[model samples]
Target: MTQTHIGVDISKDMLDIFDPRCGHRRIANTTAGIRRWLCGIGTDSFLVFEATSRCDKHLVAGAAAAKIPFVRINPLHGWHFAQSLNLPKTDRIDARMLARFGAERYPEPTLPADPARSDLAALSQRRDQLKRMETQEKNRLQDTSLAILQRDLRASLKALAVRITRIDALIRDHLRAHPQLAGQAKLLRSIPGIGPVTAVEMLAHLPQLGTVDRRSIASLGGLAPKARESGKFKGKRVLGPGRRHVRRCLYMAALAALRHPHLFGNAAARMRVAGKPGKVIVIAIARKIITIANAVLRDQTPFATA
Candidate 1:
C-alpha cells in the first residue's frame, strides 16, 4: 500500500504542513489543531518533521494517539538535504523538502515509549538544565567584584542547588515506584564505576539499551568510532554524532572506572601500555562500558566482575 507523505515545520506558535496530496497550509500549534490535522491523514500515512525542541511535543503526542506513522528527522540532516535541492529558506519550502526526503528516503518511523519513561526523561532533562544554570551563576559570581552582586548570585546558586536536590529525590522516587526500572537501575549500578546518576541517565535516555544489538547500541550512544578514508588516503577513526547526554554520562563513568583495577582499570592499563592517547583510551572505555551494560540488560543479569 502506498503511504501519503507529510512534512511538518513546527515553531513555537505555528505548524507549517506540506502534504504531497493537499499542498501547504499553516495552523496554530495547539493540541486541537494537531488533532484536526491528524484526522485528515490515514493510519499508514508517513509524517516527517524536524526535531524542534518542545515545539513538536503536541504533534508527536497527537500522532502517537491517532496511530499515524511519524519520523522525527534531525534538523541538521533536513537542512543539508534542503541545501542539496537548492530550496529557498522558508517554512513551506522546508516542509516540502522534508516530505520529499521522507518519500525518497523512507526512514523508519519512531514508536512511542512508555509514558512513565517519558516522565523520567523529562526529569533528567530538568536536572541537566538546573546544573547548567548553577554553573553559569557560579561563573558570573567568579567574575563579579561587587559584594551585593556576589550575595545575589550565591543566593541563586543555593536555590538552584536545593531545586536540583529535590529533583534528584523525585527521580529516585519515580524509579523506585517502577519495579522494572528500579531493577534495571540496580543492575546498572552493580558495575564497578556506574553510579546512581549514570544509571538513571541510562534508564531515562536509552530505552533501547537491551533491545538493540551491540553495534546499534554503540552507534546510538555515539561511542562507535567511524573510519574516515578516501580511495588511497586513510584518516583516523572518530566518534560520530549521537545522544550527547548519554555519551557525556558514559564518559564520566569511564573516568571513574579507570580508578578500579578489576573492571575498567585493567582495560585502560592495557591501552596505556599500547601507547593510546588519554582521550582515546577514555572513549574506548566508554564504549566498553556501554556494550557491557547493554549485554547485562539484555540478559537480565547484574554486572559480574569475573
Candidate 2:
C-alpha cells in the first residue's frame, strides 16, 4: 500500500482536509464524520492536525482510536510554512498546505497518557486554577481600600481554600487506586524534598522515565543542558524547556537538597566559594535533582541518601 499523508484544518464549524496524491475535501467537523473519514484510512497512512482550542481534543482522540498515526504540529510552524510557500489565507488552502507539509515533514507523534494519569493531571490543573483564583482575589483586595469587599473577599478565599483541599484529596485518592502508580509515588517520596504532592507530580510529568534510559529521559524531562552559540559568540550551557510540572518540583527539591549536607553540600560550598549567587547554586542543584529523579524512576529504585 502507498504511504498516504492526510492533513486536516480544524475550525469550529468545518474541517478541510488535504491529500498530496488526491485533491482536498471539506467535511463536517462532527464526531460521526471524523470517525468515518479516519476509519477509512489504512494503517500505512498518517494524519496531521494543528492544535487549536478545545475542539482539537476530539479530533486527535478520534483519529487515535481509529488507528491513524496522528501528529499535532505547532500551529505557528504551519502558518510559517504556509507563508513560505505563498499559500493563500483560507481554510481549504490551509488544509492543503497541511497535507503537503505532512507528506514532506511529519511531526513526532505525542504519547497519550492513560486514563488514570489524565484524571490526575486534570485534578492537578484544577488545583493550579484554585491557587490562581486565590491570588487574584488577594490582589484585588490589595488594589482597593474598601472595607466592605474585604470581608467578602476573605470569605471567598476561605471557600477557595476548602475547594483546593478537596482537589488535593481527590488527587491522593486517584494515586492510591493505582498500585503501580502508588509504588512509584512511594519511591519518589523517598528522595529528600520530594513530598507527597511533589512525588505524584513527578510521576505525572515523567511517566516515560520508567521505561527509557536515564540520560534520554532526563533530556526529555527538560533537565539536560543546552549549549548556546552564535557566530563567534558562545555562551555557557543553560536549561530550557521541559515538563514545567516536574521542573517546578525539582526547583523545590533542589532548594532542600542544597542545604541537606549529603546531596549537593560540597558542590554548593565550592560554588559559594567561587562567588556564584546562592540562588543560582540552588538552580544547579535542581538540575542535578532532575537527573537523579530520572535515574530513580528509570531504575525503579529509591534515592540513596548515602
Candidate 3:
C-alpha cells in the first residue's frame, strides 16, 4: 500500500503545507492548525520539518502527540533540494520541496520524549539560559561604577546563581527518579575528567551508546578526527561536524586530563617523542577520551585510568 507524504515548511509565524494532490496551503503555525492538519494522518505518512535557528519544539511535540513519524531535517536540505531543481526561492516552493523530500527521502525519525526526560531537559536549558544571561550581565559591570548599580548587578548574579542551582537540583532529582538514566550518568562520571554536567550530557545525548557504530558515534558527537589529504600531499587531522555540545564537553574534559601527568601528559609526551606536535597530541588525547567515554557508556563500566 502506498502511503501519502505531507511536507510542512515552518517559519516563526507561518507554516506552508504542500502535497502532490493539493498544491499548497499556507496556514498559521499554531497548535490548532497543526492538530487539524494531523487528523487521520497515518504513521506511514512522512511528516517532515526543518530545524530552524531556534528549536521546533512545537512541531516535535505535535508529532509526538499525533503519533506521526516525523523528522527535522537540516534547513539546508530544503535549500539544496530547491537548488537542484533550479527553482526560485519562496515559502511555497520550499514547502513543495519538503513534501517531495518527505515522500521520497526521509531523515531520521525523531524520538518522542517521555514527560520526565522532557522536564529534565527543559530544566537544564533554563539553567543554561540563566547562566548565559548572568555572564552577559557580569560583563556589563565595567560600564557602571555607581555603587547601587554595582550592588544590584551583584545581587542579580547571586539570584541567577541560586536559580541555576535550583534547576540543577531539579535535573538531579529527575535523574535520580529514573534509575536507568541515573546509572548511565554514573558510569559516565567514572571517567577521569567527566563531571556531573558532562556525564549528564553523555546520558541525555548519547543514550543508544552500543547501537551507534563507532565512527557514527564519533561523528554524531562531533569527535571524529578526519585526515586531510590532497593530490601528492597528506595534510593534517581535523575534527568535523557532529554533536558539537558533547564534543566540546569531551574536549574540555580532555584539556583537564591533559594537565594531569598520568592521564594525558605522559601519553602526549610519548607521541611528541615520536615527532607529533603538541597541538596534534592534544587533539589525539581528546579523541582518546571520547573513545573511552563511548566504551564506558556502552559497557556500563567505570572508566579505567590509563
Candidate 4:
C-alpha cells in the first residue's frame, strides 16, 4: 500500500491540515479534535508539522498514541523550504508545502519525548530566567544611589537567588528520581570541566548528545565551524546557528576546563602557540568538551584523563 503524507500547520488556536486525498481543511487544536483526526487517518500516514512551542503537544500525543510516524521540523526550515519552491505563505499553503516537503525529503521520524527530560527542560529554562533577572537587578542596584531603590533591587536579587536555588534542588531531585538521566548526568560530569549546572543543561537541552555522531553533536550544540570557500579564495570558517543555550553552557564548561592541564588545557595551549585567537581557542576547547562528553555518554563510561 502507498504511504499517506499528511501535513499539519499548527497555531495557538487551530490546526490547518492538508491531506493529499482531501485537500486543505481546519480543525481545533485540542485533544478531542486531534484524536478524531488521528482516528480518520490511515495506519500508513506520516505527519509533518513545524515545532511551534507547546502548541503541537496534542497533535504529537495523538499521533504517537496512534502509532503514526511524524516529523517536527523547525519553522524557519519549513519557511525556507517554502521559499525555495516559490510557494505563497498562508496556513493552507504551509500545510500543502509541508506535505510536499515530507513526501520529497522523507525526514526521519522524531523520537518520543521523555517526560523526565521535559520536566528538567522546564526547570532549566526557569533557572536561566531567574539568573537573568538577578543579573539585571544587580546591575540596577549598582547604578542607583537612592537607598530605597537599592534596597528594592537587593530584595529582588535575593528572591531571584532563592528561586534559582529551589530550581537547582528540583533538578537534583528530578535527576535522582530518573536513574537513567542521573547516570547520564554522572557520565557527563566525569569530564574535567563539566559541573552540575552544565551537566543538567546538557541532559535537558541536548538530549540527543550521546545518540548522534561527533560531527552531528557538535553541529547540534552550535560548535561546528562552517567553511567558506569559493574558487581559489577561502573565507574564514564561522560558527553556525544551533542550540544557543547548549553552546553557552559548553562555553562556560570550556573556560572551567582551561584551569586543568590534562583535559582541555594542553589543547588550548597548543592552539595558542599556533597563533589561534583567544575567542577561537575558547570555541575550539568548547567543541572538544562537547565531543568528549558525547563519547563518554555514548560509551556509558566516566572520562579518564590521558
- Give the top-scoring candidate (TM-score): 4
Better of 3 and 4 by lDDT: 4
Tens-digit lDDT track of model 2 for 1-306: 556778888988788888775778888888898888777666787777787866776677786687677777878889999999987889888888888888888566666657787677778778878988999999988887789999899999999999999998998788889888888888877777778878777777666766776666667566777889999999988876667777777778888776688668988998999999876787777767766776787788998877
Model 4, residue 36: distance off in Å is: 0.8
Report, for every candidate in turn, its global Cα lDDT versus the true structure. 0.92, 0.79, 0.75, 0.91
Q: Please give the distance, in angstroms, between residue 237's alpha carbon in candidate 3 and its true position after superposition.
A: 4.8
For candidate 3, what is the TM-score? 0.84
Models sorted by lDDT, best on top = 1, 4, 2, 3
lDDT of 4 by residue, 17-108 (tens): 99998898899999999899889888899999999889999998898889999999988889999999999899999999999999998898
Stretches of model 1 off by over 4 angstroms after superposition = 141-150
Cα displacement (Å) at residue 258, model 3: 2.2
Per-residue lDDT of candidate 3, residues 1-306 (tens digit): 666677887888878878676678877777877777777456667677787854466667777887888777877767888788898877887887888887777467766766765566566667667878989879977788999999999899899899888888888898989987788788877777778887776666555565566777777777777889889899866787666667767777877778877877788889988998766776677777767777776776888775
Clashing pairs in 3: 220-243, 222-243
Name the lDDT value of residue 26 in candidate 2.
Answer: 83
Stretches of candidate 4 off by over 4 Å are: none
Q: Looking at candidate 1, what is the lDDT of residue 213? A: 95
Q: Candidate 1's residue-wise lDDT over 1-306, tens digit each? A: 899889999999999999988899999999998999789778868899998788898999999899998999888999999989988999998889999999999998887878888899999999999999999999999999999999999999999999999999999899988989889999999887799989989999899999999999999999999999999989999899989999999999999999987878888999999999999999999999999999999999988887
Full-model lDDT, candidate 4? 0.91
**RMSD (Å) per prediction:** 1.8, 2.7, 2.9, 1.2
Sorted by TM-score (best first), the order is 4, 1, 2, 3
TM-score of each prediction: 0.94, 0.86, 0.84, 0.97
